[model samples]
Target: MSKALLVHPDDSVATLVEPVAAGESVTFAAQVVTALTDVPSGHKVAIRVISAGDPVVKFGFPIGTARTDIAVGAHVHTHNLATALDGTLDYRFTPSVPFVREAVAETATFQGYVRSDGRVGTRNEIWVLPTVGCVARTATRIAALADAAHGGAVDGVHAFTHPFGCSQLGDDLAGTRSILAALACHPNAGGVVIVGLGCESNQIAALLAEIPEARRSAIRTLSTQLAGDEIDEGVALVAELVALAKAERTTVGVDKLVLGVKCGGSDGLSGLTANPLVGRMSEAVVDAGGSVLLTEIPEMFGAERLLMDRAADEVVFDRTVKMVNDFKRYFLDHGEPVSENPSPGNLAGGITTLEEKSLGAVQKAGRAIVSDVIPYGGQVSRAGLTLLEAPGNDAVSCTALAAAGATAILFTTGRGTPLGFPVPTIKIASNSGLAARKPGWIDLDAGAVLEDGFDAVADDLLARLCDIASGAPTAAERNGEREIAIWKRGVTL
Candidate 1:
C-alpha cells in the first residue's frame, strides 16, 4: 500500500496512511520526500510548496489558508493552517448531473412490523416516555418494572428520558412537545406510554393533541399528579398496550425503508473509507425507492454546495439555501463562528478545519439528490434524500434522526461511541483498529475498505443492515443503551 494517499490529483497535501517519523521518506503523489518532522497517522503532510495566505488543498478543495510557509513533507495542521470559511455568502443553484432513479430488485424485503398507518417498523418494543423531567425517574422505573414483568412477551421495554419538559418557552417547549409526539408515534414502538407531570409546561393532554388521532390507539397516557401510584399505573397501562402491540412480523418491501445516515467520532479515514461506504449503501437503498435522511447541518459549513447542486428541483434548492444560511445565522446569533465547528478530538484525529470535516461528513449521503428539508422536530416529508436541521453532536443528531422516522440508522465513526437512539443504530468503524478495540460498539468495519474495497465492504454492510432491520439486535440494543435527546433551542421561562 502507498505510504500516503493523494485524495485527488490537485491536492496540495496528502494524508499519511500511517504515521511518519522525522527524516523518514514517504511516497506522496509519486514523489519521494523525507519528512521534516513526525506526522501522526491520518494527518496531512504537505506535498507541494505553499506560501502564507495561499490555500491548502485536500479532496480537491481548499480546506484552509496556509498560516505560514509550508515546505514539502512538513506537517500541515492547526499551527500552520487556518479556516477559509467566512460568514454566509450568496448562493445560486447549479444543477449537477440529472438524477436517474436506478432499478432495484423487486423482491427486496426485510422482516418488520407493518404499522396500520403504512409505516414499517424494525422493532416491536414498548417505549415509556416522560413529558417532563420531574417524572423522568418515574417513567424509567415504570419501564424497568414493566419490562421485567412483561419482557418475555415483546422485543424489549425501554424508557427515553430527558431533563427539559418544564421551564422551556417558545420553540423550546414546542420542540419538546413535537419530539415527544413524534416518539409516541414512532413505528418501532409497538406500544407507547407517555408519562407526564400534570403541572409541567408540557402537559400530557396538550402533547397528546400534537399526535394524529388515528395514531393514538397505540399510545397510553399517565398524569403522575392525578394517578394513584403512577409507577403501578404506568406498568399496568403498558400491560394493556401489550395487546395493542402484537409481535407479529411480516416481510416488508425495501421501498418502505427510511434510513438515517450519520457519522460521529470521525477520523481522517472517515471521509476516505467509512462515509463513502455508507454513501454506497445509501445509493443502493435510494435506488430501491427507499428514503435516506442526513443531518448535522452545521458540519455542512464549507461543503454545502455539494448537496445544493444535487437538489431535486428549484424548490428543494431554495430550501437547501435557507437551511444552510439559517444555521450560519444561528451560530452568529449566539456569538459563535460558523467555520469553527470541528472539535479538539477532530483535530487529534487529523481534521484541521470545519471545511475539511464538512467535506468528509457530507459523503454519507452518497450521490443522492436532495429531495426535502425537514425542520428540527419534523418527519421526512418525502422520499429520496432529505436533509434535516440539527447540530453535529452525536446524541442530538442521532435522536433527531430517530424522531424523523428512521427505522435503522447507519452511523459511521473512527472514534467509537456506545450510545444508541430509539432505532437500531448500526455503528461502522472507519478503521479496523477501532473496530477491533471496540468490537461490542461497532457492528460493521469499514476499515476493511482499505483491503477489501468499498463495494465488497459495503455489500457486507448492507446485508448486515438487512439482518439488523429484520430483527437482529445491534450492539447498542443488546447492551440496553436506548436513549433520546430533545433539541433545546429556546430560552427558559
Candidate 2:
C-alpha cells in the first residue's frame, strides 16, 4: 500500500498516490475509514462525508463544490465535483499575509557573458532567424553549416523559423516583427543571421529597423535571391558569424540575469509547493537587482486584479489590464471560451477551471511589484517583475519569454513533463511522487514543503536556482529537450 498525504490538518481531502480498493481500511488522521470507492493516483479522497453544493476543500481552500452527495472515503474528482465558477458567487480577495524575513541587502552574483550593450547572457549561440516562410529551409541549412563549422565550441546553432511573417495585416504583422526583433536582441544570442527571400512581405530591412540600435550590429541579413540560391554561400556566411560567436565567453553577475517563470502539468500540489518556492526565488532575484518575467496572460484570468494592484504605476496597470482583455478577446474570437484552459491532465490532477488554475499559477510571481507589461516579443528594458502578454501553452510561452531576453527559466510541473527551452530550464516537480517517478526530468523536488515547511523548500529552491544560473545543467538541458513555439494570432493564411 502506498501513502496518501493530507496537505494540511484542516484539509477535508487527501491525495492518493496509489489506488485504494473499495472497502479497504485506510488510515487518515488518527482514524481508519473503509474506502468507499477506488481512488487512483493524483486523485483525491474525502476523509468525511460531504453533501451536494458543499465546497470541496484542498490546501485548506475551496477548490470546487460537490455536484452530488459524496460519502466518506469517496473519490473526489471531476465526475463528483465541479468548479466554483459553476456556482453563483463572486470570490472576495483577502490578501494572504506570507511570513516575511528581513530583506537580504547584500548582492548575490553569478558569472555570465556580458554584451557590449551592458546586457548579460547565460549562454552564447548563433541564431538563424528566417524572416519569411520562403527562406525557412535556407535558415535551416545555415544552422547545419554553422554547427559543422564551429564543431563543439559554439553551444549550438538554431533556426527559429515560423509559419507566419507573410500575408498578415495590422497588429498581426506588427506582432511578428516585434517577436523577431526581440529574438535578435536576446542575450543568449551572440549573433543572428536573418535569412529572407527578397520579394517576401517580411523584408529584412523592416525587421532590422525594429531592433534596438545597440543590438543591430550583431544582426546580419542575407536573402536567398541575393545568395543566388547557392546553399554553400549562405552556409559560408553563417559559418563566419558562428566563428565570431564561439570566441565570446561567459562573465557577469546574477543581477544581469533575466529569469522566466512558467508552470505546466499542474496538480493540487502546485500551489502547495513548487509555485510558491519559485515565487520566493523570484523575489530573491528581484531583490538582488535582477529582472524576472511572469507571462501566460490567460493563466492570469482570475488573478489579474492581484497583479493590477501591484503595478508600479497607472500606466503599467492599464497595460496589464489591456493584455488580459486582449487574451480574452483572442480566445472568444476563435469561438472558444477563455475558460477552456487547464488541459485534461490538469483536470485529472484536480484543477477544475481557468480561475482555479490561475489563482495557483499566479503564485509563481511571488510578492514582487509589477514593473511593466510587455506584449509578446517586446523587449524587456525595465527590471523587476514584468507581465509578458502570452498564452499558457508551455512551448509558446517559454519561447516568448526566451525571445524577450530571459537568460534562463524556472519551469514548474506537477503531472510530469519533459520539455526544455533554447535556454536553460530548471524543472521543479510539485510533488515528490512525480520527482521520484520521473527523476530524469525533474531537477528539484518541492514536494518536501508538504511534509516539512514552505521556508525549508524555498531555501532549497533558491540554492538550486543559484546552481543552475552558474552553469549547472538542469534535467531538461541534459535530455536535450530544446522546445520552442511562438504564439500565433490572426489568420494563418
The global C-alpha lDDT for each of the candidates, from Candidate 1 onward, is 0.89, 0.78
lDDT of 1 by residue, 211-266 (tens): 99998888899999999899999999999988777768898777788999998988
lDDT of 2 at 283: 83
For residues 1-493, what per-residue lDDT tens digits would candidate 2 score against the true structure?
Answer: 4457676777777776556888876665566666787766666788888899998776566666889999888878878877664211233333343335554523556666777778887777788888887777778877887677774776777777777678877778888888888888887888888888888777889999988787776777887787765477666766777667754555455677798999999986686578988888778777777889999888887667778777777778777777787777777777877677779889877676666688789889888888888878776888889988888889989988988889889999998888888788999998888999999999989888767888777777766776677667789878867756766666655
Q: What is the lDDT of residue 275 in candidate 2?
A: 91
Ten contiguous residues minimizing lDDT sum, candidate 1:
98-107
Off by over 4 Å in 2: 1-14, 17-19, 23-35, 47-50, 59-61, 86-100, 103-107, 246-252, 313-315, 437-439, 448-460
Top-scoring candidate (TM-score): 1
- Please report, as a residue range, the 10-residue window in candidate 2 with the lowest summed lDDT: 86-95
| Candidate 1 off by > 4 Å | 28-31, 99-107
